[model samples]
Target: MNSRYVGYLFCGLAMIGVGSTVVVSKAIAAGLPPFSATALRFAIAFPVFIVVMRVRRVRWPRLSRRDAWLAIAQAGAGSVGYTVFLISGMKLASAADAGVIAGTLPAVSAAVAMLALGERPAPALIGAIALATTGVLACTIHFDQLSSSRGAGAFTGNALVFAAVVCEALFILLNRKLSRPVDALPLSALMSGIGLAVAIVPACFERPWTLPFDANALLGVVYYALVPTVAGFVLWYAGAARVSGAEAGLMTALVPVSAVALAALVLHEPVTSSQLAGVACVLAAVWLATFGRRLRAPSTAG
Candidate 1:
């Protein structure tokens, strides 16, 4: 297989892993404080990473000061910041609102690439971003239920969710900017440690030990650590290394699609026509992003 094709598979699988865990996130959030949940996630994942490293005889790569800071910043922005802002934002926003905002990630990441990384997006990439955002809106927002009146809390929640999106975009962009690309496993281990370190402070404030905990949520946290935190991180970085920032950004369209599919299967939820349409749109976006060069050939011809 071509490395690019393998990268696409890895990226798709990583997003699916992340999307499948959304329901688990809801369960964990219901049962535990956000900070504590975030901390526990990393704490559980870190050891597994270490054990795997030992088993594989993979020594941690020594890093320069710049690379060290980049790793820490990636951990902060993507792991801690994204989780904290998302949980905090969801508290005040409707799921629909959050979903719409979260769906903007493709566009956000592309914009970051253009502004910060000096890369111009091709037309296909732009179309993919637009379609992905539209798909998310279609999946999440039921126009009939939309209220004419808005509350300040709703606005705040939406802003926070948008902040989470920005953090995530920055995370993707920063990965592309690494002075030296860290291998996915070691990077995952390093990030898990940094995430735990940063999140533990807020977890302490949550006083998780003093509170009663739900067993199901605890189980959910462990699953989250193993699947989304551990496996997702490795697959994501590995794929991102093989693709451009815009292409990686485009892959995120699969997240909501994966989430909706998992919801239908695991939660036994009815699949709405809108959701089906949204899924189609997302699929189209992915096809456009990956194989739409033919669509571009005529336009670029002199």
Candidate 2:
């Protein structure tokens, strides 16, 4: 298979990893504080990455001082912010709602790429963004329950999740710029390590160690470390390296769709008709954004 095809395949697999993260994270949050869970996830994943690098004989890139700092900053915003806010959002909102909100991440990433990297989005891409945004709103906002019992916490949680999406978008843009000379594994390891360090201090202060200990909690931590933190990122970087920022952004729309489906199946969340429709809209939008150019063609002259 071609490298680009391989990259796309990796990205699709990464979205599966990203989708499953909500279920795993919700499980972890049941017995662990958000920050503590975040810390443990990265802390365990970092060493595994180091061992993998050693086994593969992958040498770390000699990053310049500026690139190193940029990587650290991106790690702070992306890994730290994303993990913390994601868990917090799940605490305050339904997993279904969190999934819906996360659907907007592709739009956020596209906007960040445009602003930070001057990569202009096509008109079809704009339409895709609109369709995806509509889908998110439909999934998140319960028309029947809007005036009945929707509280401030739900809205606040959604906002936090959106903030996490924006931070992730910025991270993607920064990664593209910094990844040119950097090896993906070492750069990922360094960034994750830095994020782990930042998260650990705050988690310690919050007394994550004192939280109830159980086999499930231990498994949750390990799952996050190995699946989402390590394997998910590897697939993500592989895809991002081969695709344009906009194309990469469009692919992330799958995360929320997959998450919602998984939540319905695994968590017993109700897959309401409206939510299913929203999922369809989001999926259609992603397809349009990704392949609209091919769909539209000019007549050839004989």
Question: What TM-score, computed on C-alpha atoms, does each candidate reach?
Answer: 0.78, 0.85
What's the lDDT for all of these models? Answer: 0.76, 0.78
Residues 26-66 of candidate 2 have per-residue lDDT tens digits of 77767888788888888899899999899989987777888
| lDDT score, candidate 2, position 133 | 80
Name the regions of candidate 2 deviating beyond 4 angstroms: 1-11, 116-119, 143-151, 234-253, 293-302
Candidate 1 TM-score to native: 0.78
Q: State the lDDT at 278 in candidate 1.
A: 67
Q: Residue by residue across 1-302, what tens digits does model 1's lDDT show?
A: 99998888888898877676555665676678889988998999999999989998998979898878888899999888887787677566544345445656766677678889788788887887788677756655554545534465656666777788889889888888788887778877888899999999989998989978699779978988998787887798789889876687668767766766666666555677766776666666666666665576564655
Q: How many pairs of residues in model 1 come into backbone collision?
A: 0
